[model samples]
Target: MAKRRITQETFDAAVRENMEEFEMASEEALREAVEQFESQGVDLTCIVKAVAAVSSEDTPEESTHEVLQALDSLRIGDNSASVTEVEADMKRFTEHCLVGFAQRFLAAQKDAYPVILSHCKKSVEEPEALVNALSALAALTNGQPDLLEAEGKQLFLDVLKKHREDPSVTCVAVRTVRHCCLKHEQNRQDLVKGGVLPLLTGAVTQHSESAALVKEASAALRVMCYDDDIRATFGNAHEHAKSIVLEHKGLKVLIQAAKTHFEDTSVLSELCATLSRLAVRNEFCQDICDLGGLKLMMTLLADSYETAELVRQVLSALRALAGNDDVKDAVVNAGGVQYIVIAMNRHMNNAAVCEQGCGCLSVLALRKPENCQVIMENGGALAAVQAMKTHTNSLNVQNQACMLMRNLVARMPQYSQPILDMGAEALIAQALLTHQYIADVGKAALRDLGCQVELRELWTGEHGSLSY
Candidate 1:
């Protein structure tokens, strides 16, 4: 059981003799040979030959350093080449106690992805190696894979099993799980089972730790719940998102997260958007309004550009719940109408933002006629119509403008007639004549108004008669 010094083995016969006694060597003895062999001028080939004679279990953890040195000694043609040979060895070394040696090289070092992935690339094929390799990589990126999405999910199960309790570890694994849910439908149930809701839910509720980490968990969960593409990415996450809002106490945590991190605009953007979804659930919507989300969001809309975007993103959320009597009244009580119209008019900076602001007004217009009157009188509807002519080249602006026109028309058929009378029809026609990007929707919007005009009806409507 005493440690032994590694000696020169010149040929197969010497190595074979060592192999015979390899079984008797203690862990420390095997480590001493691997640790001290190189300074003695022992050739690497001989060291490897000796390494093969030893059992995989007794392979020195420190041997990883020697192995990397030995591997580094092998000529790498380029950075790409350097990564490739190590990758092949990782595949070749599957579960070799020496594998950890390569893993440490990849995971612990900064900006070491190219090197770490070089070894992890083949983990998809070898399950045993995949788990350990993925664990090491997860340990580094907070568990999110910078690699391709598909392979990361396949490798996540093992990470879940080994690191279930560590918050950073669990957070990372849950991230990969969300990544999987968003990228493919096949893995959604698996995502739910891997404790994603609970993992994210627990972190959102725990107020004692890193506000930074808690905010991150809240964000990932928020994205899964609200973004339609992500919902379609994994059909089940929508159900999970909807269910959490409906049944679990997760809503309280999100409200807390927003209240705590709102000063951080980036985090607030996420918080506001999540509140938008929670606003869809009957119980959650009332709770969100009662929490003064509208006042906070309206303030964000009036802030700098970055803060305004949070308002734009939450527009759909507002639109979704605008029909609710309580939430609708909440918007009016919070001065939501004035803030939105100002963003579209005075803040007409980004055509996309202008369009979204206008679009949000249209949603409010449909359900609240008083809100619509405030918009029309405040010059919102005209500003949007003008933006269509000004931003004819921007499809996002054009489409959003057209969508708003649709909402405006829905209220008073008479409302859109004045826009046409003001040459909006001609501008739309000219836009259709020159820009084909949104011409069909553009022309259709124009045509819809042209056919709906009733001069007498306009004279009778609110905002009454205006000579054009």
Candidate 2:
């Protein structure tokens, strides 16, 4: 072996030459070189010499272009050179080469992304290449989604449209959808119209699809459903109402699935959440109530701990159906009042779920006075009263519990005395001191207990320590 000492001048010249030769390097040669370098513990000086030697060119312009060309070609599966050959070139001697290569490719060719998408979809069957290609798409679109040109978008749509039938590909495609679209309104519409739904739905039905991918799709759907105008524009809300509630018997599928696949919280959460929203309409509510929605929601509350959204969904459904006597009794029968009370007071858990459960319990109290006893027995009165007093700082919790308390005392006046004796009035009065909106709620609950505090009465000292 010739012992060669590498100088800065020698290093630069060798790197420049390697860059030129990179365009002609075989993937096989590259891999072999990589293997050799790894086995022998490659010298950094040798790598620099090789790169400069490979990139050396007769002209400066040609040298830079060839170096960029070689760097760009460092991507997977070229047979003419050893991967080690290319990696050593870039890893030790050519990071600037990598950035310069990427930037030049991005700037010089608007078609670069589409080419990358093509690789992700077709050029590379290897999962590693597919992953890398998808990653590149993510980085390119992270801040400049518009960087995904029309051709690239169509390329992505084409690749994912059919090939995503494979679970791995489908999962990757779901992620790509987020990156490629981000917040682009038109891109989102393209996904809906381009048959992304059926593919997603197909993947959703497949037990083998990753929990994460299904969850991501569910999240996207949840957002889409929230925008009533968008749903109306796409006609998805109508589909939601029709499928989940009525004509097609969709809820049956979920209930059946739940019996066997209880372990998959993602499945149950998405199904229950969808059912909750659909059940908000009057006809849908009656339909869900008829279909044992109460039992299923209770099951979700008791058995699932996947996400707080699942808990909130069950609570929301309970509240929607609370006007029905059967629904309220079902809630009490299901041990909902006790669980909800624990959630609010002792659990100090998710604030959203706590408020929703309270709303449902309040509604239950209004429909069935019998259920009111459950609330009291489970410390519901104390929780509600405490919410009125201590949560004056949190408007959402205060407003929700106060509204529920008003309903509780209004329907079951017999419980009002105990509720007041629990310091309900003190809590209500505290809230009244801050926000006028809930001031009426405090007064109303107090009034229901036959102890409305008139300022004049306070001055008279006729009523001592009367609380809501």
Candidate 3:
């Protein structure tokens, strides 16, 4: 037989009973309640395991903050509230939520999720109340992803479906969706299964003129494609990315939004980053190229090369798109080599830009001898060596620079000595000595560039054969 379990309410009731009837201390009562439940084989992992603070309506003696008081007012159990009452309460809650995470954590501990969820459910027909409720929900769930359960997931998708025509509602709803799904893999999977990709793409397409809405929806789309949640043994992040591109035509939608928001550097940065996230497969890489994404990225790079953050994103997108052989040729032919070199030169002090720029050049020079000459002639090698010299403390930049040097000289050894003359050997040796885990690429760069590298023999067979 399975072990019996009890609800948190039941456990709390037991603790409260011990406190009031038996005159036990609060801590003693909690301990007794825990022991009593564990003795009965009742699982308490889901229980909050704390005495109920003065957060509810009946508890008038204990003091609570205004945020908790506002949450208490929004509790919609038996009381009937007018539209104005709901709107006022939701607005108060949203304002309080904006205060900070301390108040949000307090409210979450007080079971504010269901109270706010109740308001979201009740205000579905009331646009004013619904938007305020969603804004509060979004703020409340920020970094409190444990509050978003199965019901919360369904409510998010339902709100998106119902309010698809309302950009204001969809915008906040998407913000809430992004907050709920971040660092919560199950929520991401569930929302994507509930057909969120098409809705997100539609939001981007429908509200193309609204830069704020487009940015939020685009960010949410990118969040769905993240595999950062560590709780799951495996995730469907790749599948979601594919669904966004192959099934829902996400490339066209994002590329169009990028064009629409070309002047908005913030929105363009987000779109470029999301574009990199969506380019997970080789065909998807080619799809980005065919959809004019390559040209758009080059233009963005040219226009925003001075903008460090935007330059980094554009370089990342180029690196992702360069995974394809034909895309590599396309990028090289479209002045990509020169753009990457210029971006790196402009942002020589920015480690992230240097990393992405070196990575892009490395991929463009991989296995393509013709492109290697273009990279060499365009100061790509010098830019990479300088990136290493500038960001010596940045292991990512060093590793990427090492890879770029190797790729530049892998097929076209004629450019090796020219690059080595630019102080490549010293930086490569320093990187190899500094970061052991990433030294393989650095070591290969040194060896391929005609520098003598010490080959460490790790294991030996019985016949004296060795392996690294």
Candidate 4:
């Protein structure tokens, strides 16, 4: 039988009663409330499991957070008479939600979504209040994505359409859209069908100079490409990614945005990562190369060697683009191999850079012997070996390293001695023993490199018989 569950409000109210009526300590009250609820077979997994913050002394109300107080203020006001107080009330609510996740979760349990969204509907004509209301909504929906259902999501799109020219309002509105659509597949599809891709890219184009707006808008655009809703069965992530590239020209918009914020590594990282996500097709990869994305990526890689995050993202984009045969050659011809090696050597301690760097080489050297020579000549093999040795704890780094090693020696077996001389055998063997999942690739890498590897058979042509 299924145990019954109680609302968070009920549990919190009981805790407050314990603290106020029995004059118990906050800790004792919380423990007692938890014990009492469980004794009655009421599940409390969804509850926040904490005492409410004390209300300010001047209020003389029951103990409540400032966020809830502000919520009550807006709930009791007459829409026509309290127009002026909406902005301040929304700002106050937004500030409290920003304090932490617990506050946001608590506020959501108190039905803050409709209360705050009502302000968004009422203040559409007032820019300041609208922005404040949108900002508050964005914050309140941060961890509570289910709050943005049919009505809330439509209002979000409507806000974007109504305030298209207002960058300030659009920035917060896009942010709100991102927060709501994060784990909700239905919201993502609905927003995309409502022309959100164009609005997001247009925001990037219109506010190219505003890093804040571009960052928010770019993040929202990337969120559209996610297929993260667990309930979805084979989600529309690929279709959405294709739409952003074909229907909306996402590649050109993101690359141009990266150029505008070239000096800003933070923005460049976001844009490059987005570009990688959008590179879902072979022609799209070529499109990125033709659109000067390769040049921009190389330049960023060269200039941002010291910035581990930017370097990691650039290498990731390069790795994605190199999926095309032509782009692989183009990457090698443009001195990309050497740049990647240098970045890996520079940020050897950063597991992500090393992993992505090895992945780039692994892709570039796939079935292309000439590109393999370029990778080996440019210290690609040595960088990968060092990465394997440095980040022994990182399975991704180890896996990518083994894969790169396999690619390097797969076509050109002559390079095997030098790689072995670099002490790859020990690392590869240790990795094969340490991690079970990498056994297939790691064993294949060892075998191709002319090293002795154990091969096991699990089945034979005997009825009802298994062998290991």
TM per candidate? 0.59, 0.59, 0.83, 0.88
Largest TM-score belongs to which candidate? 4
Model 1 residue 41 distance off true place after TM-score fit, in angstroms: 53
Winner on lDDT between 3 and 4 is 4
Off by over 4 Å in 1: 1-171, 207-211, 226-234, 277-284, 303-308, 323-326, 421-423, 430-444, 451-468
Superposition-based RMSD of candidate 1 using all C-alpha atoms, in angstroms:
17.9
Clashing pairs in 1: none
The TM-score measured for candidate 3 stands at 0.83
Candidate 4's residue-wise lDDT over 1-468, tens digit each? 788888666787899789889999999999999999999998675566777776666642456766788888878772644666766777788898888886788788889988888778878898887888889999999977888878887887788888888999999999999999898888899889988899899899988999999999888888888888998886778899999999888889988988899999989988988888888899999999999999999888777889999999999999999999999999999999999999999999999999999999999999999999999888999999999999988999999999999999999999999999999999999998888889999999999999999989778856966799
Candidate 2: residue 108 Cα off by (Å) = 17
User: Residue 434 in model 2: shift from native, Å?
Assistant: 4.0
Candidates ranked by TM-score: 4, 3, 2, 1
Model 3: weakest 10-residue lDDT segment is 54-63
Candidate 1 has an lDDT of 0.56
lDDT accuracy of residue 266 in candidate 4: 88
Off by over 4 Å in 4: 1-62, 78-84, 461-468
Off by over 4 Å in 3: 1-66, 76-89, 461-468
> Candidate 2: which stretches are off by over 4 Å?
1-128, 135-160, 176-190, 228-261, 264-271, 283-293, 303-313, 320-326, 366-370, 388-390, 435-468
What TM-score does model 1 achieve against the real structure?
0.59
Give the Cα lDDT of each candidate: 0.56, 0.57, 0.87, 0.88
Q: What is the lDDT of residue 181 in candidate 1?
A: 46
lDDT of 1 by residue, 1-468 (tens): 433334233332343333455643444444555444545655443233334333246642223333344234222422454445644544332223234433333323323444444444554454454444444354434322233344444445545445445555555445545543444444555555545566566666654255555655666666556444443443554576776676566667776776677667766766666666556556566776666665566666667334556656666566656757677667766777767776666656667667676666666666566666667777767888777767767767777676666666765677776766656766666666666676567756765575533222336545857899
